[model samples]
Target: MGILHTLSLLFITTPLLLLLLEENVSNVEARDHHHFGKKQKIKNSPKLSPAYSPAPAPSPRYPPSIPSDPSYGPTPTDYNSTRNCIFDVTDFGAIGDGATDDTAAFRSAWKAACQVENGVVFAPSDLVFMITSTIFSGPCQPGLVLQVDGVLMPPDGPDCWPKSDSNKQWLVFYRLDDMTLTGTGTIEGNGQKWWDLPCKPHRGPNGSTLPGPCDSPALIRFFMSSNLVVSGLRIQNSPQFHMKFDGCQGVLIDKLSISSPKLSPNTDGIHIENTKSVGIYNSVIGNGDDCISIGTGCSDVDIEAVTCGPSHGISIGSLGVQHSHACVSNITVRNAFIRDSDNGLRIKTWQGGTGSVTGISFENIQMENVRNCVIIDQYYCLTKACRNETSAVYLSDVTYRNIKGTYDVRSPPIHFACSDTVACTNITMSEVELLPYEGVLVDDPFCWNAYGLQETLTIPPIDCLQDGMPLSLAENSSYAC
Candidate 1:
């Protein structure tokens, strides 16, 4: 009718303008698929981010009775059947030039790589063997291994080596058996040029005012060894006694890392004289003296998981003269952690000396800021003019179970001074706790007829001796207190 009604409104506005041009091309292809998925998520963001992760972390839950204690056992043998020989002190031509005396090419490469049978004398990987006195004579046949991977340097500058009375132990492992001293080595005892060598005005076996001839020479001297094993070493700056194990047997000093520099004189870190079944586990002795010094014929000794600080704790004797022997007996120092040490647990005896210190035990120790945390010096070499001697030795069955923390109220956490003539018998302090710095609560005494004023000394009143009372002495003598 009007040209078919204007072509029926041009086919109904040409199907509504092709449905609004396909809805604006689907909103411009969903805005170009949301900018191409944000440029492919910023080009795959560094492969899902995490630059350097070689993977390793998450292994620390210790306390399965803290590793079954026989001094944290198990490691008798089979360290890969052991046999690692490598020795290279600059290819046996070691010329650190310090006057060139490489000690017979390091004792003929340590007796030809410790003469076979389970050998291990590997000391290569970057050499430095300027030695002076190196004697490792031994019967090290049963699984022999002395792997000190480079560095036994000593004689550098100090008047071209002057200190002499002929005793400069850089490393002398005498009378050995199952030996071992692993890699990442170093035994540098240049010892401040032997502690500035000038104190030889001697004449004292008791001459009253003249002492000075141990100037320096004892970095490592283990005489009479047995199934010995010293692992992962680092013995440094020792002018004297950094590690001395005289008369040893079945010893095992593991992961040792000793340091010396707190007025470093007579640096006694590991001194176990007259040893028997000894074991110093996971060490780090910071020395001046006795980080571990159990002198006078030690027996079944065991110091577990150690870490004594600033040194001088765990001593069992200044004991006796004429060495009447028998100072340390079946001992056990467990789960140790002494800090700022100076006698966390000591039993020093030497007012005269006779010997019979019985079964000692200090368990679960964890001292901090220590300074004589618990001490017993019958009269340990009493310095500065004070001598009322008398100790024909006898500190019996001593035990300080589960000692815990903090000390130093001018040093008197517990001081037992017995032996005016033997009277420190069967002492025991269970679950001992002293946190003094002026918080005083001191009542734990056991002195006993101290000097024997004809024996009438009795003590049994610390809450009726903590519930299980029974301490009677001569005039009767019972037990359990």
Candidate 2:
């Protein structure tokens, strides 16, 4: 009787145990599915730089973070889609013989691709296209990519350039937005002849300027554009500035190998005017003029990890030229290395201009045998014949920190040739040690009518800087501009 009872109990409990086990397995499967779905979502999310953060309004005392990686741009998509359409220059009758005038083919190709929603105007590899001074104007489709895998050479000399084309610019990209220009190709401006002209510096034994057609064209110019990216190209031997941006916004220049002869006159690596929200990163620029030149009406510009040498290191303006109202603000250049350059960092403005330059910073700079390691030449004049003017561009709130390097003994380690009436105000320098390159006699930091404070004692002490801004310029509205 006992054995029969035990058997009955076991049979009844067996079904209940099996039901619990099945429920447990279902719960485990559901949890695993939910976790996998989360993981997939994370994988599909857009990858962005964790380091980059833009500065707030007014001025930031610290360096603004930026995207660390250089690989941020458009990618491939479906070929059938209009936005993903690719138009090769060869399809438009380009010969790529290094002598044929492929300007027409390039223009035609650009027109066809520009109409597409997200088109690509491709210059295929293993080709050398000799294009003329052409203007590629566009109100093109969004996300257009100018993928250049071939060499694009300008006319061999100034004589070959068309008479109708403006000598001030070449390869103009006007009114284009959301465009990326990238490839392992070169844009070579055979500029030796242009530099040899009488008007250029190569003419005279004493490097004196002569009278002639002096306006040499920039290799590439972007006018009135937004959201532009130029990367992975070697732009070399420009007649004037290698790349010029005017009235543009949201420009990203990265990984460019821009080079010109050290004696190449007026061949500025990159020049910006009336542009804002610019980022120049991971580039090497060696030229005669400023590696990066900031002109009038520029603000919110950031430069990082650039190596500039055998050139003017970087400049903020020969602004307020010809008595124009020039206003530049919120400029920062950091993590840069300069070697054998003319000026490590410079802010130059002409006298007799009505405007201001404020909220500028240069940090983490390493200079090698640079001249004028830190300079603010408010009375900047190319020639010494510039007459002093009472009304000048107001310069204030400039900071120079972590600038350790060697400076040439020809000039003072620091030069602040401010205007008499409008003295530079609130100029701060900290952690700066600029020793003479080879001589034991270190030049004193020159401060001509400048005012500011040093956070600590610099290598060559700057005792000439006054404590604060002048009372007259404090309430002045010119600085507000």
Candidate 3:
């Protein structure tokens, strides 16, 4: 009985031990499956590389922030879509041959390229084409460009063409839109003979003021057009005005080199009349007459970044008598450097006229060796001399700021002569330092009966008024009182 009981106990113990071992094995298998599943998930999942690690993003390089100011929106730069057109002159048969008459070739190219849905008249390289008087009349689609790669040479010899008025002007662009002339090319007038022509040897029958006809051809002439652009060209030696824009709108002239000798008569760098929305910038002009002459009917014009030498600085009006319906307004000239010029800033109105000029501003202009830094002559067109007159028309709302320069003592620094009757009103000058020929700083002189200016104006020191002075008006009875 004892042997049977011992055997039973041993069997029971063995079974219990075996069952515990099985349970332990099952738990180990279950844990291994869970670990394997986790490993599989990690291997199959999308990998996260070092490049995509999240962090704060960097700021934009340009236009750091969206523009919130309405007035500070993106301006019209040269890179605008409206100004992107590449019309090559070479593709248009612009032969650079010095002897050949490439006028027909140019016209053909212009017609062909301009016929496209959106085309430009491109002058590819330097072309010495002899151009007779031709009219480039256009109702050009917007965004048309005229890219000049080379020079447009006028007829070299005076005797080569007919003496009639037909060949008087070499190139004429009339009634066009969105036109541009850009590149290092030149428009040479070849005016040696024309400029040498005697000024009609004698005067008119009445001995009246008959200006001599311009013997030389004009480099470029525009009439009754709009949205014109002339940039990056060396326009020189025109017997007449280098570029004349008459009765045009939205004209822009930038980065141009217009020059003639100091004695080159009637070589006005730019003459704008009867136009609106004109701008001239980044230019160097040296000529006989006014570097920039703003005639009657000019409004809302801006001229900046200009260097004028051996010429009149900035003139407004020579308006009078026969030309009576003259009006100019909202003109601004800034950041200019003038050397050895007759006058830094000038406004001349006819002794007898009926029109109004308003809202003119000249700022940050540096003048050296200027005869009259600032001059306003009511009696313009004076040949030998001028007398004080009461018949001058009205001029108003003119401002000159930050005009620092040296002047000749022989000529007064500031001469403001307004009409005694019509009166010039709202003329303001601030931070203007006129260093006399002797290097002495002097107060600006105000002419009497100039109208609407104060007497005994408080002057500021040179250093103190470096940038500019606030625009203000002082009340006084007499012009200098």
Candidate 4:
């Protein structure tokens, strides 16, 4: 370490070690003082000592924390201080003024941090660091940490974005294992200009199609990783999806406050695809697209106690697009609230795609002023003129228990537009109550080729739901996984 760095470590370590060892050190000192001989030696020791008492200037044995700046960071973890290898970004020439580019400093700090066991890269509180698109690649030692107690933001817009970097994602964590990114801070995307792009659906004249590529960046993503935890983060205003996890497993996301303008196009709060063993709990999200969207190849996902509003609600698949083989199963969304959203609980798939969506449950969900409270659209399409196709993904074993909500009168409360050939089967709804928000019922809750029995009488009754297996049930079993 350099002179400045040595001093920095010493300064930070003093308080942290004192915080950790104060009680033990006090007890030891009291035990020593209890002996009369040690007290007499201590009383005589000052005679042998110099005028300026050198009491071993606060032992730097433990790991260092953030410097004693006005913006001291929070305690990142409760682990033993001996296990932490701390690296502060400010030590590597980071100027956290929110305007200056801190990409190099952050990169350099991460390089050092990733080399050590139980590595911790600390972004201190009361600072805003703006960086460009960068991937923090890792095969680091287990228990790597990114303790962000401050703000992390991107450049102003696309014009300021680097041409060499990818436009699809920003701040990607690739090939990481056993990583925990927790913070009482903000990861603001500053995505106002990206939302105003000419290629955006709402941007062009008369909402017309602008002939251009409309690719904007998702704020943060974890790709090809596992055993990851992200919590206590206030992530907002993404150019596209706020947080996406792809090809990862053992993921847990909690206590996040994710938001964007309702009009911002394609700004899903959290999208997880090709991942499994995930738990998203106690998070609140309001954005343009689905609050949480589950994509293909995902299973064993439990989402609970999440609140969504002014956004499309939790969804499973806009999957199997372009004749792809998609598989999703064992997804549970329970104890959630949705309000002022487009589609509350949706499972949408495109035509001409073959796969299987099964073992899904939506329990104890409440909604207000939402359009299409519970839906399964097998023929999902953006364009008005989508030709009907016979081949489709088979959806089965879906249960909706204790779902009560109010829906916009424009769309039906419960709509199931299943494909004719591969109809949805074994669908059961128990204690579902969907009421019209405008106090006047639309009198049409449609269900097509959906085979399920209602456990209790539903409001505006689902009399359209069929009871037994369809004749095509034997043929629909071809698509499995």
Candidate 5:
């Protein structure tokens, strides 16, 4: 009876144990499958979602709206594309020995590179390339860069220049848009011979004068171009203007060191004419003539962070010469230092001009021993031959703010000799304290037909300023240019 009971118990227990073992195996397989799925996900899937990924950065404006605040520099889009499409001037039969005429080689390289988009015309570094008067004319492909790393030397003197080459300009970039000229290089204009011309101030060894033809060449000229950039260049000893921009729009010039001898004649550092929306930033200009000169048909120009010395200072030209009409407006020069300069801030216009100059601002300027700290001479004649005329370029809405300086005792700190018939209106000033550099005797500020309010009492008080516009300009709409 006992044996029979044992067999029965064993039968029941064996079936239950088999059932439990099957369930355990199935559970283990399911757990293993779940772990494998997680591993696959970890191995195959990307970490970040498309929604979380950041977007690419934006490109900079060629000529930024607030160009006085320049926050960007030139950068190539694709290095490989630029390298592959390089048109090397040396490869175009250029001899970088400083004596060979590299003009033809440069022309060839430019012609070839100008056709390719995102092209680079490279001037090899650590060499001196001599070129005669040459013009690099182009309506180049979208992104063109003239990367000049070598020293570019022009002809030794005026005697070396060919007669066919116009004495007005040497190296010219004409009709180019969306182009950049940049690199760590030097443009040496051997201008001693031109400066010694009879028409110039320095005539002969003994300071004697001689009669001769005198037409000096500008070092670089950008003519009839739009969307241009000139950066990181050192231009020295230009015969005339170092760099001139004529009929250009959306132009930017930055980080330039332009210089010439203190006695160099008519060597204006950077001159702009008929150009709009122009920007000049972070430059050092020390030349004989105006560091930065603005001619007629100029508007929306912004100049900042400039160091000008041994110069005639920055000027708004002898505009409206020969009884021509001149219209200039919206010019701002800010955060500049003028030291040992002939004039600090000046606006000189011709006597018999028709149009007007308005909406000008000079702010945060520091002058040290400047001869004429601030001046506006309507009768701006180089010689005594300029006869006075009734109609003149009307000057209005000119603001000089926070201009502090030391001036030479010879001349008054501020001189505003406006037009007699068309008096200057809204000529405002604030915090202008100009002390005499030599003595305590400070010259009084001079004013003629100038109207404005002083925000604060200046060091040498400006009691000469008269209130109210001239009757001719009050009734005329021409004053509102």
Candidate 6:
């Protein structure tokens, strides 16, 4: 070898090595700034285009600034910059290998993040974290954020589920206030094995569920929380309800996608109970059970601009079960689209129930091929053996406005079977147009003991509505208003 040959080789290789180092540095910087509200650029390499920018950070639409009623207690504000307060799960010994259990690492990271103001529990990108049945309880710092830019999942199924834990819920956030959980992440509830259990509905002969232990868990739940915001996440295949809010107030959930197979039993998209001042906006949800079911003690709740399909459309009841007293009011659902669902808008209460349901509204809704576009049944029994009773939940001041849709011919487009003892009052409907899907009406609006005022002409012409208030408002003992 000659000196000239060695010198030429060194000169050529040095520039190439320097270029590789520069590209690698850019990649590292981009990863560091991911989803943390920062900007970083990447230089071109063999794989990517020249000077490419990665996906943008998580936006500040956590509690979405929109028009709302003043009754909604408080909305969560934007989070403070959390560059120094990041508690990465990997730093606490998380493997992120998708198979190994990382439950302890997640808990530890949350605990540390909850202690500081504007603390961030960050699950970085390009990794998969597997956790178990865990609770993220808090009454801690106000501006906490959980940014999951990675894949989060649980154990494979019932066989791998933790035996010592309760099967009611997988992840719970209790007593949180002014917290924001927004991410461009995925939370995959590995629920196929649980869904295949014998106790699930329709898994037996002739549409009968088999006899077995049938305790499925909700994937994410928030209990006793206030001023919470959740947005910009994709959740799928939950064991039960995808997300539930129990006894929560001033909540805002938007830009979320929740889905499951239509055959997956009892997979409600989102269920809320005893929650107040909630706003669910601009989300898409499809599952087996109700897309959104509001239970007892919910009030001042507003749902707008949601798309639901392959779902049981939004419901306001099945309330006052077991002859209990239930008082729900001031719930409004508007500007929604539902397609191929069992029911479009329903309010059902059990017989022999006490208390009253008032000030409910469903407006500006569009439906396609729905079975029951409008229904109000005072006899909401799951089993066919429900005994008839004399007393009933007092119903009044309910309005359905501008609801246009197409329906299936199996059931009537509008059905109102009110209580025998305490009749419904002020049940108003205006501009409701419903027609059979590519067919004629096999059944008209089925009404029984319902009384209201028809301000405008109906599609099927509800002549059964007795045009006045029912005497239950003044005569019934259970009526509140």
Q: What is the C-alpha lDDT of each candidate?
A: 0.57, 0.76, 0.61, 0.77, 0.76, 0.75
**Residue 70 shift from truth in candidate 1, angstroms:** 16
lDDT per residue as tens, model 2, 9-118: 32222434323212100000000000000111122222222211322122222222323245656543343254348888999999998999998888878877777777
Best-to-worst order by lDDT is 4, 2, 5, 6, 3, 1
**Which sections of candidate 4 miss by over 4 Å?**
1-84, 206-209, 475-478
Give candidate 4's TM-score: 0.83
Judge candidate 1 at residue 81 and give its lDDT: 43
Task: Tell me how far the alpha carbon of residue 322 in candidate 4 is from the true structure, in angstroms, after superposition.
Answer: 1.2
In candidate 1, which residue ranges exceed 4 Å CA deviation? 1-85, 90-120, 123-129, 132-179, 182-217, 221-239, 242-315, 319-329, 332-347, 350-377, 382-384, 387-394, 398-423, 427-481
Consecutive 10-residue window with the lowest summed lDDT within model 5: 24-33
- Tens digit of lDDT per residue, candidate 4, span 215-313? 788899887888887888899999988998989987877678999999888899999889988877778899988899999999988777788979988
Please give the distance, in angstroms, between residue 342's alpha carbon in candidate 3 and its true position after superposition.
Answer: 1.2
Clashing pairs in 6: none
Model 1 clashes, total count? 1
Question: 1-481, model 5: which lDDT tens digit per residue?
Answer: 9645533332222434323211100000000000000111112212211111112112323346423324344444343355778888889999899998998888778877777887888887888999887767666676788887889978988789987666677777766788788778888999888887776664865786554456678888887788888888899999888898888988878888999998888899998889998988888999988899999999988887788989989999768777888888999988788889888898888778878889999988887889878888888765665676888898889999888867776677888888778888998888887776665445467788899888887756888887665555556654445
lDDT of 1 by residue, 1-481 (tens): 9645533332221434323211100000000000000111122111112111212112212222122232322232333344254444456565544456676666666665555666555555455667764556655445666555567665753455535412545566766766665556777766665554444212233433244434356767777777676766788777777777777677777667888765455577787868788766767778766688787787887777677778777677666643354456888877777767666788776655665777887876777667666667666543444455543567666777666666554445566666554566656666655554333433343342332111112111123122221243232111111
Candidate 4 RMSD computed on C-alpha atoms after optimal superposition onto the true structure: 21.5
Arranged by TM-score with the best first, the candidates are 5, 2, 4, 6, 3, 1
Write down the worst ten-residue block by lDDT for model 2: 24-33
lDDT of 6 by residue, 1-481 (tens): 5645533332222434323212100000000101111112323212211111212222223233422432222222222243567888999999998999998898888878877887888887789999987767666677778878799998988888888755768887877888877777899998888888777876767767787667788898887788887888899999888898888888888778999987788788998888888888778899888899888888888787788878888987777777888888888877788889988898888888888889998888888789888888887775667788888888788899888867776677888888887888889998888767654554347777888989999876888788776554466566552
| TM value for model 5 | 0.84
Q: Between the candidate structures 1 and 2, which one is better when assessed by TM-score?
A: 2
- Superposed by TM-score, candidate 6 places the C-alpha of residue 53 at a distance from the truth, in angstroms, of 34
Off by over 4 Å in 3: 1-94, 164-168, 200-215, 382-390, 437-446, 452-481
